[model samples]
Target: MRGKAVVVTGGTRGVGAGIAAAFVRAGAEVVVCARRPPEKPVEGAVFAPLDLRDPQAVRGFFEALARVDVLVNNAGGTPYRLLAQSEAERHARVLELNLTAPLTATLAAYDRLRRARGSVVMIGSVSGTRPSPGAAAYGAAKAGLENLARSMAVEWAPDIRVNTLVLGMVRTELSALHYGGEDGVEAVSRTVPAGRLADPVEVGEAAVFLASDAAAYISGASLLVHGGGERPAYLDAATVNKEE
Candidate 1:
């Protein structure tokens, strides 16, 4: 990855920042874009202001930037809310952020990726594989994202690779808000088979591998970084000898 140029969206903070830093650490020229500027520029990283929701803005951002050797479509999240209680517009907004934003960015970056023979690493969610009660729209969008990657891989074959990192529970700076507090985060982590939430660095490492030569032959694959996934609740019930 020494001479490769990588782009990470939503790179101002959280998992996106980690991914950008990882590429920089791996000796790649990393360019990060976000709606707001970072508090500080990552070492050896360039910041590009971008609003990925707007397709024209996304295209302009990519057009002005240098060539891309790798694209990490990592921007996305949803507010926690029950599907029934949410309005259609609200649900659509969630879908837009989690699905359409990446689509816009990917298409914008496609030409450069084709020219460079680059790869795309999409950040997916376990909620897509399982049911998400509080974040239905986010889950649905992620499920769509995975499918979209497969189609892109087929259409852009031999020139580019498209893959997904299906992430499970991850500990980020906003962990406290979503999981209550640090203690709550620990409790949630323990429920996972790995007994811990993934560190952002781990997610970044996986992205690095996907974008590097190590995954050159791998395309349209969904790599599960779920730490063995969630523990089965029925097993605990069985141990207690509970009745139906």
Candidate 2:
């Protein structure tokens, strides 16, 4: 990755920060962008301010970049809201952040990416594959995001590669908030087959691998960063007992 220029959207903290730091360690010129600055920025990485939701701003941001070898669309999140409890506008906003933002950024960076034969790595979620009861909008948007990447890969074939990293629960600085508190986090972690939550750095390494030459032949692939995924709930209620 030496001499390469990598751009990570919303890379100021958490999973995004981890990804940016990984690129820096790989000797790439990493640029971390977000609406706000990092509390403690990654060492050896440059910072750029960006809000992915703004189309014109996104275009301008890309145009200002001298070079781009990789683009990681990692900006997105949605509060836990029941489908019937929230307004239609609120759900729509979730769609815009998780789905439309990536599209806008990709389109804006198309020229530079094509020029450098760069690749794109989208941060997806496992919620898209299952029934996301509380965060339905986020899941729906992620599902759409995965589909978009597949089509983008085909359309931009022989030029730029596109892929997705479908993640499960990651232990970030904000994990406590999302998972209730420490006790809640531990309870949730035990539910996964791996017996623990995923580390942000692990996700970062996976993202790096996908964008590296190691994955040159890979495109439109959905790499699962989940820690063996959650254990099936049905087993607990199964009438038939298994001999251990």
Candidate 3:
């Protein structure tokens, strides 16, 4: 990745920061953009402040760039809100951030990416493939993101490669808050066959692989970084009849 330039959206913290660090370690000139600065600087990455939702800002951000070799669309999240609990407009905001924002970013970077023959790595979630009761809008958006990438991969073709990283439960600083506490985290981890939540660094490494020449022929692929996925609920519900 030497001499390559990479942009990681929302790269100031969590999974996005990890992805930026990985690219930096890989020798790419990494830049992390967010609405605000990171709590602490991410080693070897420059910070840029920009609102992805603003079309003008998005355009300016990419237009100011000299070169772009990889675009890691990692900026997106939604609070735990049931569909029935929120208005349609609120749900629409979630979709805008997760789906529309990335689309805007991609379109903004199209010229640079096409010129450099770069790749796009979309950070997706397993929630999109299954039921996501508390975050239905987020799930729907991610599902749309994957589909959009597929179409982009075909439309852009030999110029740019687009792919999605379908991630599962990942351990981050916010894990405790979402999982209740340490014990809750452990309990949740046990539900997965891997026995633990994935580290952010692991997700970063996967993103690097997808963007690198190692995956030259890979595009429109959804790489499952889910560590064997969830164990079937039915298996735990079954009762055994034992005769003494």
lDDT of each: 0.92, 0.94, 0.95
Candidate 2 C-alpha error for residue 80, in Å = 1.1
Instruction: Estimate TM-scores for all models.
Output: 0.96, 0.97, 0.98
Query: Total clashes, candidate 3?
Result: 0
Instruction: Please give the clash total of every predicted structure, in order.
Output: 0, 0, 0
Residues 1-244 of candidate 3: C-alpha lDDT, one tens digit per residue: 8889999999999999889988998999999999999998899999999999999999999999999999999999999999899899999999999999999999999999999999999999998999999999999999999999999999999999999999999999999999999999999999889999999889999999999999999999999999899888887677766344
Task: List model 1 lDDT by residue over 1-244, tens digit each.
Answer: 8989999998878888888889998999999988899986777888988888889989998898779999999999998999889789999998998899999999999999999999999999999999999999999999999999999999999999999999998888899999999899988988888889888888999999999998989999999999999877778867466675
Give the CA lDDT, 0 to 100, for residue 123 in model 1: 97
Task: Flag the better candidate by lDDT, 2 or 3.
Answer: 3
Off by over 4 Å in 2: 242-244
40: Cα error in model 3, Å? 1.2
In candidate 2, which residue pairs clash? none
After the best TM-score superposition of candidate 2, give how far the Cα of residue 243 lies from its true spot, in angstroms: 6.2
Question: Residue 134 deviation, candidate 2, in Å?
Answer: 1.4
Which tens-of-lDDT digit does each residue in 1-244 have in candidate 2?
8889999999989999899989988889999889999999999999988888889999999999999999999999999999999899999999999999999999999999999999999999999999999999999999999999999999999899999999999999999999899999999999999999988888889999999999999999999999999778899878798766
User: Could you give the candidate ranking by lDDT, starting with the highest?
Assistant: 3, 2, 1
Candidate 3 residue-wise lDDT at 115: 99
